[model samples]
Target: MARTRCDRTPAWAQLQLAYDNSGKAFDLRQAFAQDAGRFEAFSQSAPYVFADLSKNRIDAATDKLLFDLARQSGLQEHRDAMFAGEKINHTEGREVWHVLLRTPPESSQDGSHRSVELAKVHETLNAMLAFAESVRSDSGITDVVNIGIGGSDLGPQMAVIALDAFATTGKRLHFVSNVDGHELAATLKTVKADSTLFLIASKTFTTIETMTNARSAKAWFEAQGGTDTARHFAALTTNVAAANAFGITTTFGFWDWVGGRYSLWSAIGLPLAIAIGAQGFREFLAGAHAMDEHFRTAPLEQNLPVRLGLLDLWYRNFHGFTSRSIAPYHSALRRLPAYLQQLEMESNGKRVDAEGAALPFGTSPVLWGEPGTNGQHAYFQMLHQGTDVVPLEFVAVKKPRHALASHHTLLLANVLAQAQALMVGKVDAGGHKHFPGNRPSTFLLLDDLTPASLGALIALQEHRVFVSGSLWGINSFDQWGVELGKVLAKDVEARLGSGDTTGLDGSTAGLLARLRA
Candidate 1:
């Protein structure tokens, strides 16, 4: 289906007019005072997550216009194209079906056209879970080291820590992604080679950072008299030939449709599966699948992802907010902002549209943040009184897993108070103490940060990103920007040893000399 770019739509003109008329000076406090049902009108419940979007700089009129923008932009059809297994990621000529990774076999069978692909998905999922179970039951394996970068590293590492309470196995899961030998070396020092199971998790088995760490890990294992590479090391990769060459027999493979940032639900989730057990892993998938169904079938007016995505556009395009701060109130979700940075930035940080045409508007907002309370001390001051209005997102869990009632109460109170303080700023006669109220924020709450809720939350973010990217008419699945840096780094690495300055720019040559010095 031919998609309409957001700026070219009739609704876009109305939105521009709306923003110019009142959106530029839109006051959250005034909006609330004027509209009695604003909170209920904006708040939405979807799957395992409930969102309070009332505090955002939007009203009923702008929301309706945004819904029209979604319709005019062909977001519904574009989203359907992805779920239908079309090669929507035209750059790579692959279907963007990370959603399929979470789909149940019975539900997947409903899409008869994708039976073959669905079969492959379940086959790999079953095998991966079986392997995870084996590792979980293995008492000898005291440590599980996952060697991968990007999706392989961030997704699994974040999930493992977030689901630490659910980990049945006593095994410590270590993720080494950075090519910096310090991270891998430090992790290796803590675990003995004999009791450690290394999972190499690059799809091609040749990601430079992953392979570098894998090679070092292998050498350390062999040096420490650790034999049985087949038992000690497994490959979560499609390249069986490369795995065999590297002395790894156990391999789990996912499809080409699964891109790196979105590969968490694929075999890349083995570390998480081992940590939380097969049942928990399945629950995680089920939770995400529920969100997927909501995104697929729900009306635009009632859709959580649609509402959030349109709000993102309202902030970025009209409000001219260049950044969004993600403050997960839970300590376990400390890495969430970092993971989302990659998920959103890498997915939609393109300068061009899907057809390679340069975009006239901004795409992704710079997503950055730390866990809350910590952020309250550090950057919360800047957020409260800063010149630029960076929209803040606060993620809070209603229930705590721990029995510390007072601590949990304090945590919940802080989250609520912070959101309130952002909106209802205290008026001070002194200029330094004055806080301009009506700062926008979106509050996301989960009943508990279990595997199911975590899965739903992550999936909600994924689809929300897709909604924005779809309207912007960009290929959300591709990350061509990251390749140029990698390609340049290879040449720089080679130049460091050879002292070859040929074709090197002045800055590169100068930096090379300084580094060598």
Candidate 2:
């Protein structure tokens, strides 16, 4: 695979021209007042997603330039290559095909050939769902301990909590991601081994944090006289041999093409499949597949992920925005920011291109935020009155999943009002009352928080990450940066036991002493 850097084109030059001229002073209020059709012109619908981009600081010329930038950057070609199973992930020498994982069995051209892989996906999903169903129905098994980190823990944990209503299974889900033994110890105190099922989620069955936790859980289970090892312990890992060696007979596997963050559609989503059941899990895949089809077939001008990615490029490269705040209004989506933090940061947080050449331009921006009302009480002040002009992405749901009518109305109102407040601030004649009303924000409205809609939303985010990473000419799949920490941690752990300050940094020595003391 040849690694090509996206060259600045005529469209980028035109964008520079536009940015110098009228686009620099693009104001949302003035644009809205000047154009009655601003909202309709800017807002677009795709499947379960509706975007109100009129709240953003962009005009038609801005969008045209963005589209041009996309063209010049060869975004369409990159996107096409990914869908066509080309090795876009140049560093990994593999095709990025998490989308293919969610593709239904019947949708494949040859079911027999595809059956092995497709059946594995469905089989694990089915088994996990059966386990979740049994646990849900059983009054005895009240606690589920998910021992995994990063993608394994975040995706399922987030979705299970979000769709709490659909979870009539009555099992409390506990996710243990940190390597801290205290976390595992705390979880162990609440449930007995007989009542708890530990889902050890690791793609390689060798992640240090995951394996450490799994071993500790197993030790605790055995020490506590937990007899049903096969019944209580299940491994969500591709390395069946390693899992079996670890005394885990029940195991599930996913392919190399599935990145950890994108593995929820594979067996890595066992926890989610267990919590939501086979049908709901299928709906989740179908939701993502719907967005997949849309992304594959939609025009560049009308594409949601493309448009968002283009805006991301414009903000990061041209407008000089450093970070993005993701504010999901629904409490269920409280973890959306963390999920995206990994999705965007891990993918595009690279200093080098595919060929290991240092990049001249910026790649991924720092992404951070909490849920809406909570964030409003906490960091929304910084967002509104902070020194930086951080762009905010507010995700709101049109309909509520629960019957709490008043709470839903208040949530929607707060979301809408927050966007409006950001755009049209209260004017004050006094010095302290002065308000900067031109803060830009984008509102993404979903019809409901169903499994399918969640899948679509997540897939949309995945593709957007792909767009930015592709345009930046970086490999989004591989995570070489994560290794340095692991290596350093080993040295630190040894130093901690030895109390040796020799050849260690002053800060490290001090921290080690403090920890030991």
Which candidate leads the pack in lDDT? 1
The Cα error of candidate 1 at residue 279, in Å, is 0.5
Tell me how far the alpha carbon of residue 10 in candidate 1 is from the true structure, in angstroms, after superposition. Answer: 0.5
**CA deviation > 4 Å runs, candidate 2:** 1-7, 107-140
**Cα displacement (Å) at residue 215, model 2:** 1.1
Give per-residue CA lDDT, model 1, range 1-517, as digits (tens).
8899999999999999999999999999999999999999999899999999999999889999999999999999999998998999999999899998988886545546588787888989999999999988889999999999999999999999999989877889999999999999999889998999999999999899999999999999999999999999999999999999999999999889999989999999999999998999999999999999999999999999999999999999999999999999999999999999999999989899988899999999999999988999999998889898889999999988898759988988999999998898889898799899789999999998999999999999999999999999999998888899999999999999988889999999998988888
Residue pairs with backbone atoms closer than 3 Å in model 1 (clashes): none
lDDT (10s digit) by residue, model 2, range 1-517: 2324554467766777787787678787898889999999888998789998888878888898777767777778878787766777777788787887887765543545345556666666667667656766778777889999999988888888777767767677899999999999998898888888888999899999999999999999999999778878888888999988888888777778788899888777777766777788889999999999988899988999988888888888778898999999998998889999999999899998877889887889999999989999998887777788889999999888778659988988999999998888767788466557788988899999999999999999999998888777888999999999899988888888989889888888888999999
Instruction: Write down the lDDT of every candidate, Cα atoms only.
Output: 0.93, 0.84
Model 1 CA lDDT for position 125? 94
